[model samples]
Target: MSLKLGIHTGPQDLSMEELLRVWRRADEAGFHWASVWDHFYANPLNLREDPCFEGVASMAALAGATSNMRVGCLVFCALFRNPSLLAKAAVTIDHLSGGRAEIGIGAGWFEEEFREFGYDFPPLGQRFEQLEETLQIVRSLWRDPVTNFEGKYYRLPGAVGSPKPLNPNMRLWVGGNGPRRTPRLAAQYADGYNVPYQPPEVIRERLDALEQACERLGRDPAEIGTSVNLRFHMRAHAGDSDADPPDNYVPGSITGTAQQAIDRIGEYVETGVGGLNIAFRPPINWDAYEAFIEDVLPVFHTASA
Candidate 1:
């Protein structure tokens, strides 16, 4: 399979105009996908004063700004919105992007955001239950003419979702770093599975688990796409030895020279992921990003071709 390259930008610590510029640049540079993240607060939770845009609105802006690449949010927190509302929003975004919108959902983790925002921060198990219920409701709403779901957390009775997605096969993704339940959930419900900020070994293990889950469920493993998200911190030039990634940099980050970035991406391809998204946080290294668009992307695109 051809490996797709993408950019995953968190909608925090950046202006709307800057975000749109990045998205438009990725689109023009032939990226296959572009995605935003969902969070009520800027991650690492350093301060409450940080500027963070909401996910759904940012996604709508992304759809309006980009013409080529697919637009999506990496994962919308299931606890924040009703399933019916999310489903309708996804369909509307699909229409806005002319059938280039995908959606991902997950059990949320930001407890501070939940509590501070007046949302009940349930235990992990309960959150997972809610997430599963949300998945079922969203699928039914998108596929079935009328959705009627009776779950412990949510009840949808005879809900009709009009103006179905512009793309009949618009993908729904399940994203997390969990090993067992996440894979099982993806096998049962999602069209795609995504793991973020994970090393190659961990990603391979997760993918293997997903395959096993698919086998146990008697479903085709190939039916669900797999992807990994890595932190991007590329150096501007090949000789910039001192310009290393931060000491506290997360695992699976792409750093160093253009050639090194290419090789690291190759390792992910070997893990059997169909796509890789480099997560961009501010202040973005524009020079490194341009070098990636100019030097690194072509190598993979040409090889895939």
Candidate 2:
């Protein structure tokens, strides 16, 4: 399948009405997917540190608001909630959206959220251990009639979650850049692998690693999909030159005019990325989103066609 695009609004700064507007607009514009992040605090520093809505609740709202676009959290922290409960929540959202919900999970990062919320900010290895267990439990809870899991970090004894997902084939996206454990987890338990803010070259290397991990598991590399999420900046002026991208540009950012953005996306496609999830640092750039959909997205659709 050709590449698809997703929008990440990140549940920050925007009021509830504005958030709803953005998701509805993306859905109406025929974007393939939309996501909000799982965070207790606003991510961008400039935003007035106001009330940030919880991730899953925001996704539930998005699912209720949009009919066509798939909506979910982008890489919810495993440490934030009980794994089985998380799975149940996803199933509920899926039913709400008529099977348009997905889950993107990762080992918890962002120490600030952890400490403030009183979640255990365990060591890296322990966190990965929890994440692996979480993935396994979530998959089992979604698929099995009665799930039983025993792990160091989490345990399930004769656990059964009813109202299985509306879509039996719901997707689980794994997000992380762990050179070893992350890719292996994606190979073993995920439908999709996603990396945030990594440039095309960095993404290519991760994809290579994932392929190798898949091969080791005797799984076809094609079985797993890959996507990159990055901060995006579109140079708005028509007179903007197609000059070389700045050397000091942020690591996982795409910044350029329409054609330049297209070329950058093309580089990612050439590297075998199956989707691109675009996020903007606040103040939210609705114009860039609209302009890209108008001017750049069609070029990709045409090329793929």
Candidate 3:
């Protein structure tokens, strides 16, 4: 499959109008996918007062705003909402986008959000249990006519998920960078797998684990699409204040000149990932973003074609 280019952004510290503009611009610029992160507060969690939009609602607006790109959240914390409810929301967004919607679920890590929001911050292993049950429930609801499931974290009795997704092949993604269990769970349950902010070598290692997991499960590794999300810190010009990345800068970010950014993305492509998403944080650099659309995207898209 050809490599797909996408955008991932959080709905924090930006107005709804600005967010829609970004998504619409991505659509017009020929991005293959556009996604939002599921978080109650702005990530890297500097302040509790920062305005952040809810994920499900943001996803619906994303579907309504963009016509071409597949819209998604990567991902929703499994413990935050009932699995069945989240599945229904995904189906609704799929229809809203004319059958272009995907949803990703993960065992959430942001403990501050959990504790402050009054959610029980259980141990990691237990959270993964919730995640596993959530995936089973969601998949059944989306694909089955009548769903009946009984798991440790949740139970559904003869439930019907009406008005199934507009597209039967609508994807469900598993997102995380966990070395073992994440990939295994993804091989068993997800149509796609995503790891965010990891360098190419780390990504390659994770993909290898995924392949091994698929082999052990007697499944084809090709069954799951894979992607990585790179932080976007490209510079528009020499003097741009935000040109310098933060002190706690993530490795494998897309930074520097357009050519340099292209080179960085090439490294990820060489790892055999099917897609790469440039993650945008608020206080966006419009010039830098446009430079990417004009100078960088064409290089990879042309190569893929």
Query: Which of the predicted structures, 1 or 2, would earn the higher TM-score when compared with the native?
Result: 1
7 in model 3: Cα distance from truth in Å? Answer: 0.3
Q: For residues 66-104, write the lDDT of model 3, one tens digit per residue.
A: 888989999999999999999999999999999999999
lDDT-wise, the better of 2 and 3 is 3
Candidates' C-alpha lDDT: 0.90, 0.83, 0.91
Candidate 3 lDDT for residue 160? 94
Candidate 3 stretches with Cα past 4 Å from truth are 238-242, 302-305
| RMSD versus native structure for model 1 | 1.7
Off by over 4 Å in 2: 44-48, 239-249, 302-305
The best candidate by TM-score is: 1
TM-score to native of every candidate shown: 0.97, 0.93, 0.96
In candidate 1, stretches whose alpha carbon ends up further than 4 angstroms from where it belongs are 241-243, 302-305
Instruction: Return the clash pairs for model 2, or none.
Output: 197-252
Order the candidates by lDDT, highest first: 3, 1, 2
The model with the greater TM-score, 1 or 3, is: 1
- Backbone-clash count (model 2): 1
